[model samples]
Target chain A: MIGIIAMRDLRSLFAQPLAWVVLAVVQGLVAWFFFSGVGRFERLQPQLSRMSDPPGITDITVIPTLDSAAIVLLMIVPILAMRLIAEERRAETIRLMYSAPVSMSEIALGKFFGLAGFLLIVVALTAVMPLSLLLGTSLDLGRLAAGLIGLTLLLAAFGSAGLFFSTLTRSPIVAGVATFGLLLFLWVINFGGVDLGPLQPAIDYLSMLDHYNAFLEGTIGTEHAIYFALVTLGFLTLSVQRLDAHRLQT
Target chain B: MEERSTLIEADGLQRFFGPTQAVQDFSFQLERGEILGFLGVNGAGKTTTMEMLTGNLAPSGGRIELNGCDLLDNPRPAKASVGYLPETLPLYTTMTVDAYLRFCARLNRVPKADLDEAVATAMRRCGLEDVAERVIANLSRGYKQRVGLAQAIVHDPEVLILDEPTKGLDPIQVREIRQLIRELGKSHSVILSSHVLPEVEAICTRVQIIHEGRLVLAEDVSALRARMQHSSLLLGGRALPAPESVQGIQGVERVERLDDGRLRVFHDTQSDTAEQIVARAASEGWGLWELTPERKSLEQVFVDLTGASESEVQDTNEEMAA
Candidate 1:
């Protein structure tokens, strides 16, 4: 049933004119970011190589693809996930879904996979820029792969959070806004403008940006992997519970 | 241990939105092969009851059983048997009608082998072939409604629960849907809730009326008509004798003169013996006006059943427990 639902959802994604436009915009931005970030890094590499032990100022070729991908993800993903349940509820189609034999878990998982599948395709297409980098510059294979892994994991986390917000209301716009708001808060809360005393350790560990930090250095951290996986599972479980709660209200 | 004839039952079913009880202690039973019509005003618990029966909503209290399976205890079994169409027909606007129906079939776990035939049959049954490939967003409301009906019946569950199935449609479309429902009733036990009195009178075998979350009355079509007991038989013949003579027959409760001067006889009877009535009139050499067994109208019964007339209160009380 999940496969069946996901198939329909994926088809819907490709069928829409708006989706095509979003896809084009993402490609254009990702390509620009890749070239611009790498070009700047290569120009600085000559003077940087003369210096000993450059921390964050060294060549950014490896991290640029991951950084730009995260930016594309954070922007493009909610639009995809916003329509998952909220649009159905708004259009009164969720009632049909509710009456079907499929469980809420299957529906949530189906939407996740459906939206994730789109992101996967987009992520795959963006990899051509990084692959081209191998022809011109020395690239660390392990670090590059780890960065891609971190970006995919982060996308899953965002997708799950977006799905949870979708279940909060019947309005897709509200879902989109609220999910983006939550993501913004998550990003900003750790660095400044918030109390960081008792929650400092937990907050830092759980931060979506923090989890992707190791990927910038081209190293896969088990801690990052575990944290991201837990975030995805937590949001999905919350989404399913919200659906069950709404079903009871009907 | 009694062999239950009730195909579906709700006991003390209740739902509350904050302090307002949407449905309260609402209980009723649907017998096998019976088309149960639930009548109500807006917010009168009709859809709420249907939802609870179909396992779409959980009741606040009491138990519901369908085919002797507890609806509350095991919703899966009951829900599996239910084919529900809610007031707002849920549809995916992007998919074509055929694709949407197939998706519904897949969700219901229709076997891979059965998918094509099932989709085709549902389309054929619901008259959906002409626009099968058209996107649902482009379709007309009536056709969209047909798609809604198609999705519900495509899986062919045991019980069909329709809420306002003919809600917004032309007169002809309403007739078609009613006919479709009546045809479905031949196989499946159907429970449809409608505020339309005449439609209920025309199609349903039995009706359960609810007012403000409580049951008012339930009765079989013929029995409900019998409550009035005023038979309207039109006998065209040579006008003759006194109207009082026919009124004197056994089981003849009352007689009223029509505009044509043909008398209408109200009778509570074990059997309508109009033949015996005619025979006695013939032997008396009286010019018998009209003497035919009249079929009482269900409309009159509906009015009396729900009306506030003082004289009807006693009969209403007696028929309320059906």
Candidate 2:
């Protein structure tokens, strides 16, 4: 049942021109970032050659490019995920699922996976820009793999949060704005002044950027993976519960 | 255990939106091969009741059983046996007609082997075969309605619930959709809601009139037609007698003089009032040109049953127009 709904959503998403436009914009930004990092690396190579111990190309060029890609994803994800459930409610097409024999959990998971599948393509396309350097220079394969996994998880978390916000209202614009607002807050929560008495560690742990930064550094900590998992699962469960409550409330 | 013939049974259903009760003490049963027409004014709770029956909305207090499975407790099995088309046509406009029906069939859990056949059958039944390849957004309103109907029956559920199926269509389209609904009724038990009373009278076997969230009237179409055999008679003549003289007749309750020099006589249902009036008109040379028993239309009966004043009915008509 979940597969059926997910496939339909995927098909519908691609049928619209918005998905193509988003894909083009994300790829264009990633290419620009990748080339700029490479240009900066070329300028520093001669100075680094004089030193006995110097930074490699992966540290200076690849990490910055992947880091900038994550930021780009943050801005585009809410736009993609906004229409997942909110458009269904606005068009009154949610009644089709409600009247069907499918469970609320199935519907929520189906929608989450649908958006996740589309974002997976976006992440893969963005990663291609960094991966192309392998033909000419040695790239850090392990770090790139970790970065890919981290980006996938981040998109999943963002998609789930967007799905939850979509269930709160029938307006896709409102859902998009709410998801962007919440995600922006979580992304920058760790940037507060470091003098907090006892809440600094907890706030640091909640920052999505901090956890994603660990992946870019090639250190795939279990704690970071668990944090992403928890956020993703938490928002998906809230979406399912909100859908179930819709039956009771108008 | 429920009777084998009963397809749907809703009992004592009540729903409230905050403090306002939308539906109260609503109850009805649909049997096999029955097309039950639900009649109501706007905001009379027809859509709410349909939503509850289809498991889209949970009633505040009540029990609903579809095919003997409790809707709230065993919704999957119960909902599997039913299909619903809400007041708003639910269509994914980006999808082609064939793709949309296929998706609906899959959602309904139609077996893989029979999925193609189910989609084709639904399309053929809804007269959508010609528009199968077209995107739903490009179709005309009537065709879009057919696509909505096609999706509802794509899985061939036992109970089909349609809320105002012919709502925004021209006369020809309305007739076509009504004919399609009648054909579907032969195989599936249907519960339809409509403000077009004649459409209900034309296709439904049983009629349910809902007013103020209550089931105001429930009767067989034949029985309701019997009730429509009104006791009033329209009397037209060149020279009519005084109203007091017609009131003097036995069983004649009162006489009303119309603006066109005609008498409308209200009489007891049990008495032979028409016969007596004819005899008096012949003897007194009243020059009666026409005397016909007035048959109350379904609209008049609906207004009388709901106790809606003339202006209120006028308001309802204007609301429907706009």
Candidate 3:
């Protein structure tokens, strides 16, 4: 069933002009960040290398600079995920989905994975960031691998969050706004001093930013990885329920 | 001698929206190889009924059974045998006609090995061969309608639910779609909803008329026609005797002239004795035209039986959707 849905999404994306535009814009941004990060790292290395670093240059320049890839992913995710469910509902294609033999779970997972596939390209385009480090500073394979793992999980969460918001409205613009707004709210909510102190422990575990920090330090924390996975699964599960209920109600 | 093939049996189905009742106490049954025309005026709960039966919208009360499988209890299994073509067609505008049907085929769980063959057959059957590669957005309205038909039948389900299948077609297109429905009726149990009474009469075997969210009548199309009090007359060739003179006949109650120049003479007594007038016309050399009994159009039958033609929610919805 998931294969059927993926096949449908893949064909739809390939055929739509809007999908092509989204793909091109995401790839352009990722490419721009890759070269710009490498250029900035090159210019900074000469001044910083002379001073004794707290950690090796691999930790200082490579891991930290490559973290820009995650930022690039953040910008690309909501755009790709915005159209997944919103457009389906707007176009009445959700009716077709509801009437199909496939379950709501299969539909959600297929769309999640399909959006992830497009987002993966944005993630993959940032390969130049790590490869550039290899050409100059010696690469830290462990940290880079850890960072990649973390980025994949983060992508899932972002995609799932976008998917859930997409379900909330029929307009892609609304889905995009809601997704980015939710993420921003999550980021800013922790800043309140009263809420931060009391909720800091739970906040850290729930925070996507903190979960991603583990990979930047060349560490693989199963707990952190699970946190991102849980967020992804949580939002996606909510999305499935929302859609199923909506289907049953109307 | 034959299988008791009950494709769909819906009973006491109702849908409410906030303060207003959309569909109330709706019920009907469709048997295999039976083409059932579902009739209602705008907002008479036609789409709502289709939605409930096809598993898109849940019923607020009552039950829908497909081949005896409870729709509310297990919608997927019940839906597996049903194909719904919504009034709007539910097409994916970005995909080509063929591609969309192939996608629908997969979604409907058609076997992988026969997917291509099945898609091809559905497209061909729906008269969508020439525009297979064109994006649905680019197709003409008539072609778009055919594509809707293709998608609905792509998986070859046993029960086909079509809502206003010919809502926006010219006369020729309507005729063509009617022919297609007749062909599909040979194998599938079809429940087609339309506001046009004549369309129901043209192709359907049984009809269920809903008025004000309730079942008005569910009977064979011919039976409904028979129940209508007034019988129509079919006159042909040159015109006949004067209206007053025809009305002056012994059994003649009223005589009205047709737009076609033929006279429609109504009678209450000696129904078979209209031939006496024909004989009189012939003997007097009064240039007798053709005289034949008029079959009431389905619209007249519905107007008579339902007694709520313009007021049904489903019928009103049929208009709004149009």
Candidate 4:
């Protein structure tokens, strides 16, 4: 049943121009950033060789592109995830689904997987830019793979928030706005809590960027992996609970 | 052996939204090949009750047995045996009719081996074959409604619950959907909710009327019509002594003048007042142009049982919701 709904959502995603447009726009911007980083690396190579220990191409070009890709995902993912459940409710088509033999868990997980599939495609598109360095220079495959894994987890966490917010309302616009607000709040919390003495460490630990920055440095930690997994699981559980409560409400 | 199956047994169903009791103590039994019409005015909780029956809403109180399976205990297999179409057509307008129906079929657990045949059969039954490849958004309102019906029956469930199946359709489309419902009643037990009395009279075998979230009347359609017989009389034409003279006739308890100058006489259910009125009119030298017995319409029965018009009740419900 989860496969059925996930396949349907994926098919609908590819059927519309929004997915293609978002993919194209985000890829275009990332490619421009990638080339600029490469050009800067080309110009700075002479000065970098003079130093005993110089910055490599991966550190200058690949890490920055990955970080920018993270920021781009924060902006584009809400648009993709907003329609997962909210649009169905707005159109009243969700009544058909809820009335069917499928369970609420299946519905939530199916929609999560559907959006995950789309995000994977976007992640793959951006990963290609970093891997393209292999044609001319020896690249750090381990670091690039670490960054890709982190990027996918980060998007999945954002996707979970989008899914959870979408289930909270019937309007897709509201879902999109709420999701963006949540991601923004999560993104800036560490900076915002800097002055709140004693609570600063707790807030910093909750910040998503803190965990993501480690991955950009070509390192993966157990705590960072656990944080993303817990965040993703928490929101997906909230989505399931919201849908179950809705069955009783409606 | 021609054995009928008992498809659904709902008992003590109750739903409350805050302090408003939407449905209370609702209970009924449905049998195979039975088209049961659920009649009520707007805001009378008809849709709420249908939602509970179809497993879209959980009843605050009560238990529903679908084919002997307790609904709350095992909803999947139970719901798989039932098909539902809500009042508002639930459709994915972006998908082509063929694709949407197939998606619905798979969601309802129709096996992949028989998916094409099931979709084809449902489309053929709903007259959606011509528009099967067209996007639902591009189809006309009538065709979209047909597609909604097609999706509901794509799995060929043993029970079908339809909420206002003819709403918002042109007369021809309404007639077509009603006909399709009647045909479905030959094999599936159908629970149809509507405020339209004529549609119920034309398609349903049994009728249950709900008012203010309670069942007020339930019986066979033929039995309800027959029960009205011998209780009312429609007397037309002029009487030399005036219309009130029919009140003096035996078995006539009340007489009122209709808009068309016809006399509407209420009498004891056990008596034949029409004969007495005709004999009295002839002897009194009255011009007896027409003396037809008036059987109570479902509308009259509805109004009498609910103590308000369907539209009026609907208005009150809407106001409360607002």
Q: What is the TM-score of chain B alone in each candidate?
A: 0.72, 0.88, 0.84, 0.87
Clashes of each: 1, 0, 19, 1
lDDT of 4 by residue, B1-322 (tens): 2443888999999999998999999999998889999987777789998899888889999999887777899999788888999988899888999999999999998999999999999999998889989999999988988888888899998899999898889889888889999998897889999886667889999999888899999999887667555567777776534556777878778888878777778888767677777778888777888777777655556567768768875564554343
TM-scores of all predicted structures:
0.83, 0.94, 0.88, 0.93
Those runs of model 4 whose alpha carbons end farther than 4 Å from true positions after fitting are A192-197, B1-4, B230-232, B238-241, B244-249, B255-262, B275-288, B297-322
Per-residue lDDT of model 1, residues B1-322, tens digit only: 4645677877778888778898887877787788989976666789888877776676777788876778656655566667888899888888899999998888777888999999999899999999999999999888988999999998877788999899889989999999999998998889999876668878899988777788878888666555646455544345545667777777777767778766666666664656656777688765666556655444344455556465554454344332
Cα deviation in Å at residue A61, candidate 3? Answer: 4.4
Docking class for model 1 is acceptable
DockQ of each: 0.44, 0.82, 0.64, 0.74
Chain A TM-scores, all candidates?
Answer: 0.91, 0.98, 0.86, 0.97
User: What 10-residue stretch in candidate 3 chain B is worst by lDDT?
Assistant: B229-238
Candidate 1 vs candidate 4: the TM-score winner is 4
Give me the candidate number with maximum TM-score: 2
For model 3, the superposed segments whose C-alpha errors exceed 4 Å read A52-57, A192-197, B1-4, B228-250, B254-265, B283-303, B306-322
Better of 2 and 3 by DockQ: 2
Which digits, one per residue and each the tens of the lDDT, describe model 2 over residues A156-205? 99999999999999999999999999999999997867667698888888
lDDT of 2 at A213: 90
Segments in model 1 whose C-alpha atoms lie over 4 Å from true places? A45-59, A135-138, A193-195, B1-6, B67-69, B228-322
lDDT of 4 at A56: 89
Which prediction has more favorable lDDT, 2 or 4?
A: 2
Measured with C-alpha atoms, the lDDT of residue B158 in candidate 1 is: 74
